[model samples]
Target: MAHIRSRKHAAAPQPAHTALALAALTMPMTLLAQQAAPAAAGAEATLPEVKARAAAETPYKADAVASPKFTQPLVDTPQTITVIKKEILQQQAATSLTEALRNTPGITMQLGENGNTTTGDSIFMRGFDTTNSIFVDGIRDLGNISRDVFNIEQVEVVKGPSGSDNGRGASSGYVNLVSKTAAREAFGNASIALGDASRVRATVDLNRPLDIALPGSAVRLNVMAQDFGVPGRDEVKAKRWGFAPSLAIGLGTPTRTYLNYLYIDQKNRPDGGVSTFGLPAYNFGANTPGAAVDPKNYYGSRSDFDDVTLHMFTARIEHDFGRGTVLRNTTRLGHTEQDFVLTGVNAVTATAADPASWTVARSRQARHQTNEILTNQTNLNTEFATGGVSHSLSTGFELIHERQNQVNAQTLTNTTLPASLQQAVANLYRPNIDDAFLMPPFKGAYAKGSTLSAAVYAFDTLKLSDAWLLNAGLRWEKFHTETNGATFTAATATLPESLVQNAPLSLTDNLLSWKLGAVFKPTADGSVYVTVSNAYQPPGGANHALSTSATNQASPSLEPQEGSNLEVGTKWDLLGGRLAATAAVYRSENRNELVSDGATPASFSQVGRRRIDGVELALVGQLTPAFNLSAGLAYMDPKIVRGVPGATGNQGGAIVYSPKVTFSSWATYKLAFGMTLGGGVRYVDPVVRNSNLNNATSANLPGTESYTVADAMLAYEVTKNVNLQLNVYNLFDRQYVAAVNNGGSRYVPGQPRNVLLTANVAF
Candidate 1:
């Protein structure tokens, strides 16, 4: 836990609006020096209205990708894609989705995972666990919440084994999110940020072009409001509100229809972080007391909370069946509801040599979750030819009907522990505990379920020779799980005796998933690829429970965790085409996995395999029109070479948070007058909290000690419609430890420097 201390003594001074935030970096560098533009040169005949006005102001990278449902290009997508537009999350004044995925890198961010519910949003990519692979415009988005990029307009990631694009995902990557539709032209924007513990946020967007009821209709609206916090943890908080509305209906006409809706409401304050037994000023005595704490100490419970509600509705219909055939149909209907009363600690095992005579146990979880989904996807794109080759087909069908409900309860809010303790401990720098304790009633419903999926898919790119290309795809699904209910008599002595519900259980599966790729294109801006994919995950995990095993009642059949990915990549489009570079090398595996049953200890068996080999590099867009970049780097090596045998899987451990290296970069320029400055640096190594792949027994579990973290930004265009930005997060205020609890007791820190100041206003 303690391994950072120099960004000039971390943080504590500076603010006086830091000289009005360095004078708003000077009105966007005097409007980029009065709209520079003077260097003359060659021009032989290359006009398509100046390449369509440089692709409409090139908002930094993203030349294609509509979820491999076809819109390829990202240099002909073979695999490995990243994209996070929305002007790089408003130049990093990011608002969630893990700060816009830290601008591309081998994603990692564990934060919570002690009990199945760890207060939402967890991540780990490349080395696996994309926390259910997320997605929005592309559907999915089931449980474990926390997402918001206001109304996002970009955030793709994709990467590997997308079994032909999402059906059970993330053999190594997935994260789609693209919303903010409806547009003919009309516009409006708004923003507000301001940060530092009392962080506040506001956002708004509006668009309209509706001629009322018909005539090239259009409508859009987005809204968000926040009251954020969590810099150094303490009374961590977050208050949220969201809304998105969209509508569109024929504009250029060929039959189009869209109507989207989203809504979110969140209430926060849940951060049970800090504590690592013996950190930095290590002093392992009383069995392993801890010290050097204070990354904003806040031992959970201040009336711990979490309440969320999300809503979604989508409808899309496009019809173009003319020569290039097209037919789309999308229909979504979502709902999510979460309730919480978190507060978990437990990580003190007798030991109290000092560190205020250690002790510190705390628990009080209570939950109520709900999710509902009703999807319907239908697609058909076309182009055909045969012998001379030319394919580009795409076919799809999807139908889902999901339902899930869960309720967990527990109370033992440590009234300073004693009554046979469910959580009792105190004194880790000050004893006593009680935050108006009283929060355990949420019985009813232990877990409910329903799942029905039916899918069909097809894809083909072919084109085979004008520079060879040959993607392929396949998909087939048919799952049907049931379990209308399951109970635990409300909490029989800390439950988890391996639930047993032999009545009302049902299961079924089919899954077929597949993918293949090849691209060559040596010129349209370069590409070179090779891909292979497959994915699965059937057995009732995302809610379709089957329970049954309270000491084995003939229920032990769970299957479906297959996975695959094999990649090789290259993408170019250098300078002349406005930057973009990429490289990849991958290998991922997961033959079944889900081991742990060397004679049933909570039973689980799937033959485990787990692997991950990687290499990646990237650089994106506009290296010049006044610079604009986004970088990435990776090196993963997740392991578990075989079946389980302790020490975290087999071949020596190492998957936990899986970080063998990761990097994130950010760049911005437009210097001289439209002022913009940028900075970026993020490194992450040292991980292995448990999943053994033995990094030499990861110093007794609880890993995460490498750190870099830095960020900066400044913008000004104070009047191109008003703009002003400031950003800066952890600009080296690195305290490091962001998640680790393989017994090192608790953690989750990493956030210090902090600073944000925005004011955008568009029109």
Candidate 2:
């Protein structure tokens, strides 16, 4: 049994100001203790477990994941699910969600924000943008901020429409982050790392059983601080710090309660990236439209920045009725805010004939956005036998109340520019500009809205016989949203309403999502399955803020987008059920997509359609006791089936950011003397932009090109309680595009070769 000899935090006391900020996040709750030094602590290591049990949990590498409400093993579930565990993250030194997701297949990043707001985690899977389809511990995170993984236990990428799991999952799928919680153990671990470009990061984790007399009671704390620079970019950097704490009462008892909280503060020197102009179809040859700028060029001002803050608190209770019945309830409150300015660019003189003459017209966008959510969930799980069959059933319900606020206005250039937004000139070929430290002047509010949603769902897995299994689920949701309709003048001398007109607002929608599947198990380690699922996304909630009906009165007809997926897949447990592999063929489509009606100006109809046909392959887990591997590949064709007359290009063509092929693979092997080696590669095919698709000018749009990058890692366990590790990213230092500025001229440059060395010690 694990026992504690002393009661102390894991780290040193935080500064008074920092302490105050943390205290605000812990308002009603109590801050038990921060992590203290591990010098006198006892070192411990054991297999992963959701809760304390008599036996240590089995490690299947990346084979199994329990997300939100899932109780079945990934191999037993019918849908395609990819699980990335803590071990995999450490091996890759992936500190953020984006870095970790790049290791999967068919994923791309897009810039999110209006004007100068580039603070969103614009991730796409399959062929659709899934920026809002992010969840933390089953609750929607409800913002466009990049999320950190410092306190996450694992990440589950559920492929395909997931409205049944979330109210408004993206057409392609959703990402669920399972956070670390209080565990019944007495162990502590800490790590500090440094890398290229003056990168510095420190992290700590401590889990302590609180009381000896109490059978099940413990508290866990996690903290992280980091300051890092973009290896290839000039003056681009990111800095952040956060803390997570969880406490459990009656952890190992029949009746248990848990409380979890998270707080994060971040600031970044945003990168607008390189331009997409003149390049050879294959190289910078004379064939393409314009010259390719050096990958290291900085087109945006160095003073551009993105700042964000996030806080969340959750409470959960569970009761076991013995005999295979359990009840669980969870409630969470979350808030997030973002402020930033991004450099917008227009090609002025970029041409292949005079490649060196390329210059860009530059402007700035300033934005402030905020979101808040209060949600609750309850579920009942039970197993019973009837007649000649056994059934595992789960039923749940959820309630959510959310609010979104956005105020976007650029800096006013009050001079010869005649009170216009900030405007400037930039030399794209070779930047000669410097940071101006310009920020947006006071502007009126543009959008304020609130939403309330409720849903009830049930799922059942029936074992008709030993060889065949059936699964079915259905969810009924009621959603309502409306504009706050508040008026504010900003108390200015001449407040022009032009800067604050209310966009289309107000909506009421009822959504029904469902799933069905059948499985044939020919062997204990293998199964073949067919599954069908559907999701509903209401009109005007695409960006979380609904379009006011008043602003969209011209177009009277609107409806929720309908998406469906049909897949046939097979999963196998190889090498004595220690390794797992999955292969699937599927078609996913979205119908009734909102598009403008040719006959009417500013009017739209749900007559558009988009679809993707694809095949996916994944292999995860151990090939041998000493070797672990995870690999995935996807081939997809996404196209538009309808068009808008005035939308200019992008119709009847491949969608933006949807690559035809993407592949990733990572493997680790253990050698003698506690040494391990790891390596992986990522490949992405060329991608197009929506606004310029199918246009002759597309050559000037700077589309993403096909590229392959590799990464490597080396680690040695000096002792059972100490380990040393190193990770090298972009091993070949390939120059490539990481992301486009989302329907804009600015594109992101990929990272250069950089290395991080870490010393991890456990007590």
Candidate 3:
């Protein structure tokens, strides 16, 4: 069938109420500014008293790690960035990367076809699924696979399209996992944890300066390993094991080098049985027996997968030329190879009555990826007097190259009904038990898909007089992509045919992206800013598909997706910078929008425009002298302006898997005798199923109901060098589906309540 696609153009204008709302949000900042004057004066008047208070409070040093050099205060950043620290992950006893992300607002997950082990990790951010943009440390770790969290120091989520800095990725956002690094001081820490799911984990981090006898350098290493046996209902079980090791060396005074490697292997059974027949819309019920089948005997088979191994090497050098000028260069290279085998019954065509006629399929896949990147950044970053005004300039150039190869082979077998189902059916026909059907090898490969991007960017932050801070930046990027591979169709009676083709396709494009903003900081702890930015993504190999036209049309040429965002926000600190809050309202419009049609399998056409408007509120800081809290609430309204002609009228609503509202909060309080207690709650709004459809004939699946989850943890200090912690996830034992397929054939249920105990020793 020929695909139908159309394009639309619309100019999104901000509403008056939106401006008013933004204005109101700034009142707190203004109020805080007005209050700071008197407090500073009072401190000066009572210098002795202030000094005495500072001395007394200095005894209780905070455990929070200082932000890295590249990181600025949250309020000072031009864009939204959420940082999840190592302490938070340890305190919560997070098992997987997904569990850790759940605490962050405006993020969601969609399950893969297989179970958690082999079923790749699919994540959504800001209403879009672009998991390929995920990064390890500072380099890209593209592909569809479960990411390991061991030896990770923190995770940073940079909201909004990061194409300028992250190359081609999700137009919505990107996630960066920062690996643990050696410390300058001598220190060592180790932890062991046991959880209710039969989960066991151990990690150790140590850093020691090189002996004085060694030549001008320091070396350190970190290592971690974990094994988990997950317990599930109905005879389902999942297991995983992994390890990571890293080494770092500092050369001279201004140069550093690091090397790291990771290896993970996992084997597990499917979480639940796949449905044999399609179910009705809005069926949130449990799995049950279908016609001609016994639910008791139907289950999925075990699968084994491994991330195999990954190697990364990096070098950084910094040079300071006096006179407030510095130049820094960073280079990185990474390589990864993965292999796995997945086994499962074809749910699309299976029944208990004809159990003997059931068909089982097994697939083996391998992937190899490599990346080389270099960045040179120079900063004058100094204030200078010009025309009685202060000016600051920063510039940088980055070049990146990434290439990957993916291969897969599948085999299927069909057999007659088993003795257990002989009475249920009179006649059953099965495919021949030939060698071809037993383990027929159907192989396909995607080879030499590579991307190269080069960017030169500069920005200036000018103190235009004392009342206003004006910032503007522009980035010019050139991107090229090439892919050479073959496409294969699914098997029918036997192994489907592979269309052998190797037509190398390449595309080059140059685009300019820019950001402009103005911030007015009336006082040290208050500021209001308004910004406008433009971002774009070049078409890539993923968009390639087969065409029936003669001469084998190969991959079609598509226009790039472009977006513009407008935002206004205000930030404030109350109670002497101890409590902070921020509120923002933004609207984004996209051109040459990409939309998925459920009818066409795996075909994505760039057509129809869309827009999204949302409001976000965040608060982080101490609620009282002995208590701390962090919370976020977000509301989004997204709509489609145009869809396939004659299909749906301005089909606009919540994007698939994108909830309308989300809320998350956490609080921690100090207890007696060097102890602390903490807990958090999270809520996701109901999703509107089939909300993108235009006609009544299309299935209008009801949206999933909203759900709330709670988690708590308790910790006590055993000694200066030892500590113990206990954490409980899903405190209420809430049972709900985490994700559902469009046809409702495969559903992923949320994990059950789990408890973990951990002990840590530091020296």
Candidate 4:
């Protein structure tokens, strides 16, 4: 068993706590006494031996997911799922959700569109966009702002088509972030860290059982504050603070209720990325090489800023009945508002004869946006027997309303600016930070959209025999969406025009998703399974936005896109159930993609198809009493199955931002006398982002090259209540491009070597 750390309650002491602390302090003597006593001749084994089993549980592995919809444990679950527990986050000093996600493979980051930067977590997984598929405790969380992990319990990533698990979503799957809640336990913990580039962060988690009329009631509060600078970059800053408070009633009784509230505020300076003039695989035409720009250059204006405010309220109740039956209901209201003014770079304007006169054209981008959601869900879990078979079943129904409102800004992209606005053209080698430019005007253009959905789903796992099991799930949903917007219009000589109002657009759709799987267990600790699943993505399903253009994918008249996945996998529990190993081979496809119709008017059709075949291997949990490890590797082959004939964009071409291989691993080992050593490595294969199908194989195309990054950590326990840790990122300081825009004109460079020291305290 792994070593256990004593937990001291901040509230009134209990008998169990005292006994556990005493037993830990005198383990050697207690073990000898147990050997001498021999359980008192089978007189109902007393509590003396309970402390042995009370040792702290391993944090590297989890047996079951927190969601009640999963009817089986991770070892028996017939899907590709990865869970990232909070302990791992603490050891790595990861403060953001995106940073923590580096533990998994086959996931890549992305820069924004042409001449812009994508806000929040712009993630690409399994060759598909997953930005809209993020959830918080089973409820869709929509926004373009970044997320903090201070109040999170664990992050669960469900791979493959999981439409049966949630409503309409990405074909690649979704990410669910579980929150921390109050329990019938009392403890207090806090941490403070300081890192390079003027980084500082602190957080506190406190939980205590109430001594009020409700015997099992408890309360928990988690708070965080941070101010940091982006490594290897100048004039960039991130500042944020947030808190989560939870209350629970009847925690240990037949009836339970929980209430939680969250609030966060942020003020940050967004990065516009450095110019990509001098990078590898880049040229100045006719096979002429270009000079690389400084990676640490800050091309954005000092006044550019992004501010956000968020609020969320949730309530849940559960009831348990005899004979293994339970019911639960959850409701949530969430809202987020963001306001940002950013600067972006386009292609460079070079003067070959005079390199010092080269300049890069700049543009302005801004948005005032808000996202809101209201949802309620009810679920039931029951276990029963029918003749010779046993069944574990889960059924649920959900009602959701989601909305997004955005105010557009008119960017000043004209190159014929007066000398007073010369800041729009920045010097390629030596830029002036004090240069000034006027903010673009807004002509009162705005867009507002909403989606309303009702869904019912059921999942069941039937145990046919000791070595055989069958799992099936089905979901049916009905949805309606509406989008309304207005834009400024220019007047002609014959008529006068002003703001033009577009008619309200509406769409309605009914969707059905299902999955089936069979498992065969050859031994008590191993299982082999094969599964097939399906998902659907209707028009305006992700963002609740519709378009009138016939060629647009979000047009209300278009049909829904369809996705399917097939997999054969195996799972094993070794090292006395302390370690888990899994391997899977999967084939996933998405059809009904929008493509050129090849007609006179140049319309579009939904006949395009894309496919990806991949193999994944993973290992997680404790390798020995003093060692812990988590690792994963993925190999992918993505192709365009059907597309517009001879089109350079998709015809028999590779998808953008999709890599062929990726790997990530992290491990930690305890040394003698309260010391630990840890390290990790991450690798991403080269990715092509160019639209020209024929140029996909060319070296000069706009894309990111393969890169590897390494990190290390060391920790030492100061006393029973305090410990110190230090983490070093980019151990080798390798220079590489982390992400590139589709236009390939700009790129976000990898971070340089940096260090952080943290102190943790518990009482």
Q: For each candidate in the order shown, give its overall lDDT on alpha carbons.
A: 0.71, 0.73, 0.55, 0.82
Query: Which residue runs of candidate 4 sit more than 4 Å off their true CA positions?
Result: 1-56, 286-289, 415-420, 490-497, 597-601, 696-701
Evaluate model 1: give its lDDT.
Answer: 0.71
What is the lDDT for 487 in model 2? 36
Question: Which residue window of length 10 is worst by lDDT in model 2?
Answer: 8-17
| Per-residue C-alpha lDDT of model 3 across residues 712-731, encoded as one tens digit per residue | 98999989899999988789
TM-score of 3: 0.77
What tens digits encode model 4's per-residue C-alpha lDDT throughout 1-763? 2212211111111000011112233344334433432332233232233253432357788766777777887778889889898999999999988988899898988888885587788888888888888988878898887899998888888899889998788878889888888878899999999999999999999999999997479989999999999889988889999998888876655456677888899999998888888787775553235588888888878788999999888877665542446667777778899998888877677756677888878887788999998777878888888999988888999999999998877775546356566868888877766778667666556889999999999999899999999999999999999999998765689877677888889999899999999999998778999999989999988778899888889999999998889999999988888899999999999999999755566667899898989999999999999999999999999888877656545677777788999999889999999999999999999998864576544333368889999999999999989999999999999998888887777888899999999999998
Evaluated at residue 567, the lDDT of candidate 4 is 94
**Cα error, candidate 4, residue 164 (Å):** 0.7
Off by over 4 Å in 1: 1-109, 112-122, 129-146, 149-171, 180-209, 212-214, 220-234, 243-252, 255-321, 325-356, 359-382, 388-390, 393-459, 462-651, 657-763
Q: Evaluate residue 451 in candidate 3 and report its C-alpha lDDT on the 0 to 100 scale.
A: 68
Q: Once superposed on the true structure, which residue ranges of model 2 sit more than 4 Å away at CA?
A: 1-63, 112-117, 282-291, 350-358, 411-423, 432-437, 485-504, 548-557, 597-603, 645-651, 691-693, 742-744
Candidate number of the best lDDT: 4
Question: Candidate 2, residues 1-763: lDDT per residue as tens digits?
Answer: 4322211111110001112223344332222211211221222112132243221222325544554245455666788888788888877888999988976899999864323435567888999878878877767777767788889878889999878877676789898787888887799989999998889999999999996676688888899999998787777778999998887766645556677788999998777656666544422223335546677776666667889998887877665554456666667777888887766554455454565655666666667888998776777877788999888777999888888888765443323134343346556677754645366554545677777899999888888887898988889998877774333344346765444354455677788899899999998778999999998777545555554443342122466778899999999887776778899999999887766655544666667788999999999888877888899999999988775654464467787789999999999999999999999999999887553344434434546779999999999999999999999999998987788665445677788889999999999
Q: Cα-based RMSD of the predictions, in order?
A: 24.9, 7.6, 13.0, 8.7
TM-score of candidate 1 against the unseen true structure: 0.32
- Summing lDDT over every window of 10 consecutive residues in candidate 4, give the lowest-scoring window: 9-18
